[model samples]
Target: MAGTNLKCRECATTYELEPRYVCEQCFGPLEVAYDHSRFVDDVGALRRRIQGGPQNIWRYGDFLPLDGPPGPALRSASRVGLPAGCTPLLRADRLAERVGLGEVWVKNDAHNPTHSFKDRVVAVASQRARELGFDTLACASTGNLANAVAAQAAALGLPSYVFIPSDLEEQKILATGVYGTNLVKVRGNYDDVNRLCTELSGEREGWAFVNVNMRPYYAEGSKTLSYEIAEQLGWATPDRVVAPIASGSLFTKIAKGFEEWLELGLIEGSVPTMNGAQAVGCSPVAQAFDAGADVCRPVKPDTIAKSLAIGNPADGPYALELARRTGGAIDAVDDDEIRAGIRLLAETTGIFTETAGGVTTATLAKLAARGDIGADEKVVIVITGDGLKTLDAVRDTFESYEIEPRLEAFEAAVEQGVHV
Candidate 1:
C-alpha cells in the first residue's frame, strides 16, 4: 500500500503500479518505488511498529509493495497461505574458526516454509496477484521457485502452473509436484524455460506469472532478508554479507534493503561489503566482475547448483555495480569446492545446505583463504535452501560404511579410520 509507482531502474521513468516488469521507454527493468517520508518523523515509533507486528515478513509490510494497509486483517488473510520469513540468524563459532574468520553468522533461510528463500518472493507476488484480481498463479523456476509457487498457490487454493527445466533435480521436482500444481517440464535449461514463460505470460491473460509479469513486486520480497538480518542484529548491519547470485535479484535487493533502512535512520551502518558467490560452471556475473566489464556474457550452464544456473542474470549489471561499490567482489568456485563447502558447513554448523549455499560457503572459504576478508570483520553467509532439495550433491562426498550390527565390526571400522 505504501508503494507509489513502478519506476524504471535505468531511466527513472514511472508507471502506475501494475504487473509490469519492464519499462516501455528504455526497456530497462522496473521496480517498486515507495514513499517513506511518513516514517521519517519518529524512528523509535517505526521500530516499535515493526517489532510489534506479525512474526513473519508481513511485519515489514510498510516496506513491501502491497496495495492495502498491513495489519492484523491483512496478516490474518496472509496466514492462510505459507507465511515466510522470520528465519534464524545463527552465530556459527565453529564455522567461523574453520574459515579463519573472527566472527561469522549464518542466515539460515532454508528454514522457510518451502525449505528455501523463494517462499518470501512468492508470498508477496501471490498476494499482489490476488489483489489485482488474477485467476491463476504461474512461474518459470529452476527448482526452489517451483516448490514455493506450487505450495503457495495450493495454500491459497488457486489453480497454478509451474514450468521448470526437465533436467532439474528429481527431489525438487517431486517436492513441487506434491503440491498438485500443473508442472510443465520443458526439455531445456533454465534460460530456455524462462524465455518460454516470458512468451506465455504475454499470451495468458488473468494469469499472474510471479517472476515474469509480477517481478517488480516479487523482487521486493528479498528485501525482507535484509530487514530481518538487521533487526536480528540489534538494528545493526553486518560488516560483510556473502550470498549467492542467480538472477542477481536476491543479492542486489539485500543491499537495497540495508540502504533503505539506513537512509530512514532505522539501521545503524552502511550497506555491508557485499560478496557474491557463484558456481564457476554458470558464473557470468563473476566472470564479468573479474574482467572489470560492465556487461555479462551469457553461457550454457553446466553446474550441479541448478537453483543458481541462470547464465544470463537479469540483475547481473546491478550486481556487479553493488559488489564493486561496496568494496566487495563476486567470486566463483568449482564443483569440487562447492561439494567441499557443503561438507564444511555441515561439519561445522550442523546446517546442510543445497548447492547454492554450497557455492556461497565455498566462495567465503575462497575469500578467507585468499585474505579477502579481514580477521575482525563480522561476516554473514546466507544459506538459501535446504540440502534435501539437491541430495545428489553430497552423494559421494562423505563415506558411509555398511557393516553388520555388531560392536566388533563398528570398532574395526573405526580402527580403519572410516568413522572419523
Candidate 2:
C-alpha cells in the first residue's frame, strides 16, 4: 500500500494503518500518509500506468490506501462491488453564461452507480474493511451514504447495517431498502444517528462502520474526485473549485488530492481557490469561516438539502483554514436560493443535481454576482448527488400544463398561457 501509516493532522503522531480515525494524544483527525518515492522517480511512467488501468477509481490505486497492488486479481475481484469515480467533468458553457463567468465546468458525480459521490467513499472504505478482516459493512448516513453502503454491501455479498435519520427523504430510504440491508432509522437528525453509530461501532464486533472506525480510509476516497477532475482536464488544475461541505471531509480532501498530485509532478498548477458551499440552516463551517473563528459552533440543521445537513462538521476548522489560505470563501444560501440554484443548473447545464448541488450552484452564482470570481478564471462546481434524490425540492417550483389531448386545447392553453 502506498499509504504508510495514519498520521494525526494536528500533532503529527503516527499509528499503524488499522481502523482508527482519531489521535489519542491530541484527539485530532487521522489521515492516510503515503510514501510516493517510487512514483516520483517516473512521472511519465506513472501517468501511463494510470491511463492504462481500469476505468474506475482503481486506476488511481497507487494514490489510495490499499493493502497491496491493485493487480489483475484484485481488480477482477473488486469489480464485484460498485466501481466509483471517472464521472463526467463537462464544460458548462451555458451555465457559465448564466453565472456571468468565462469558463465553467461541472463535475457531475451523480453519474456514479449510486447516483452520488458517497459511492466513491463507500467503495474504498468497504475494500479496506475486507482487507482488515471485517465481515459486515455499516454506516450512519444523511442519505446518499446509506444508499451507497447498502448497494455496495449487497454486491460484495456482505451483510450490512445502515443507520439514518428517520426523517430522511423517502427516495433515499426506498433506494437503500431495495438492497436488502438492515436499515435502521433513528428518531433524530444526522448528528444523532452518527453519535449512535459511533457508540455501536465500539460495541459491535465484526462490523466495519465505514464513516466511524474506518473514517481515515473512508475520507481518502473523496480525493479521487480531484484526481478525476485533473486527469479529465489533461493534467491541469482549475482556477477555483466550488464544492458543498457536509462534514467538510469532501471539501478539504479535494484540496489534499491536488496537493498530492502537484507534489508528485502528476498535475501542473497551484491548488485551486477552494470555495465551500452550505445551506443557511446548517452552515456551521461557513459560519466559522465568516466569523474568522478557529472552531465551528455547531447548529441544528433545518434545510431541504438534507444530504449536506451535518451540524457539527468534523473537519470544519480545516475547511476554514483551507478556504482562507487559498483566498476563497465559504458561503451559505437559503432554501429559496437553493431551489433557484437547482432550477438554474438544470435549465442551463441540463444537470439535475440534488439540493447539495443547488447550494453549490447558488454559492457560485453569489460569488459571480459579487465579482469574487475573475472574468477569465476557470471554475469547477461539483454536483454531489442526483436531483431525483430530493424530488420535493422541485415540487410546485414549476408549472405543468394539462391538455385534453387535442390540438385546439393545446393552442388555447398556449395562447392563454394557462391550462384549460
Please, what are the lDDT tens digits per residue for candidate 1 over residues 1-420?
879999999999999999899999999999999999999999999999999987889899999999753455654443347888999999999998998889999999999999999999999999899889998999999999999999999888899999999999999999999999999999999999999999999999999999999999999999999999999999999999999999999999999999999999998988899999999999999999989999899999999999999989999999999999999999999999999999999999999999999999999999999999999999999999999999999997766777889999999987897752
Candidate 2, residues 1-420: lDDT per residue as tens digits? Answer: 879999999999999999989899989999999999888888999999999988888888998898753454554433448888899999999999988999999999999999999999998999899899999999999999999999999888899999999999999999999999999999999999999999999999999999999999999999999999999999999999999999999999999999999999998999999999999999999888888898999999999999999999999999999999999999999999999999999999899999999999999999999999999999999999999999999998998789899999989888999942
In order, what lDDT does every prediction score? 0.94, 0.94
Model 2 Cα shift for residue 130 (angstroms): 0.4
Give the per-residue Cα lDDT of candidate 2 at 389: 97
Model 2, which residues run further than 4 Å from truth? 69-80
Off by over 4 Å in 1: 73-79, 418-420
Give the best candidate by TM-score.
2
